[model samples]
Target: MADIEVTSTCEEGYTVESVINGEWELVVDALSNDGPSANEVLAADYASCYIPAFRVAADKHGYDDVGNIEVDVEADLDEDDDLVSIAFDMSVEEDLGDDEQDIVELGEDICHVHSALREELHADIAIESGV
Candidate 1:
């Protein structure tokens, strides 16, 4: 296995400063009142993971000209148990001559983030829309 590290600092309520390396910095904010909770982190992670997976799936299905894949991830928090559930709806504009269905199916199947979240975090997930 390889090692990866990211550093994060909290400035104020529900907002965090994150750096993957010394060069890049990102400010992340949480939507809920509680602020930059684990829910927001989970949502970001899901979004990041799904896009790349979809790209790989697209390429495998001969979508050589696949462009501008968009993924929206939402994490809903359960007040009772304090669990966060995630969902992803992704769309990609591709011009695959005869492999559109294959590309879509492959993209859906290769969404490892969804499976990992379901298994690791027991998240309730719905792939609401895809194309």
Candidate 2:
């Protein structure tokens, strides 16, 4: 078993900063038109996670050196500006292209981020208020 954690702070409106391993990793300003929104983070993370998983799946299928596979992840939001759906698209390098569907399935099965997404988003709320 392995453990991972990231700290997110939203001290300024919709802007959030994520820190990992005591280093500032990502800064997202949801209120800014040019910055990445929360959903964008999800999409990017999905693709980032899947890319490695894809490599693993390909290796498992006896494919060596899958080359550089391009991936695009998109998030669709409703009129309320809430994340409603996520879509993943990728172009596998010809050198390792085989059973794409199986690769996707295996990738999702192995990717930790994919696993977290597959599981329901449940949080055990903890509150600390000082007034």
Q: Best lDDT goes to which candidate?
A: 2
List the global CA lDDT of all models.
0.61, 0.66
**12-125: candidate 2 lDDT, tens digit per residue:** 577878887666588888765646877777778877877798789877877766676776565677888776666665666544334655766777778887778644331111
Best by TM-score: 2
- Estimate candidate 1's RMSD in Å: 4.8
**Sequence-dependent TM-score of model 2:** 0.76
Scanning candidate 1 in windows of ten residues, the lowest lDDT window is 122-131
Assess every candidate by TM-score.
0.58, 0.76
For model 1, residues 1-131, the per-residue Cα lDDT tens digits are 23545789976666777877556766666654444555666677767766776678777766555677666666665665354555556566665545555655565567666666555453333332224
User: Could you tell me how far off, in angstroms, the CA of residue 114 lies in candidate 1 after the best superposition?
Assistant: 4.9
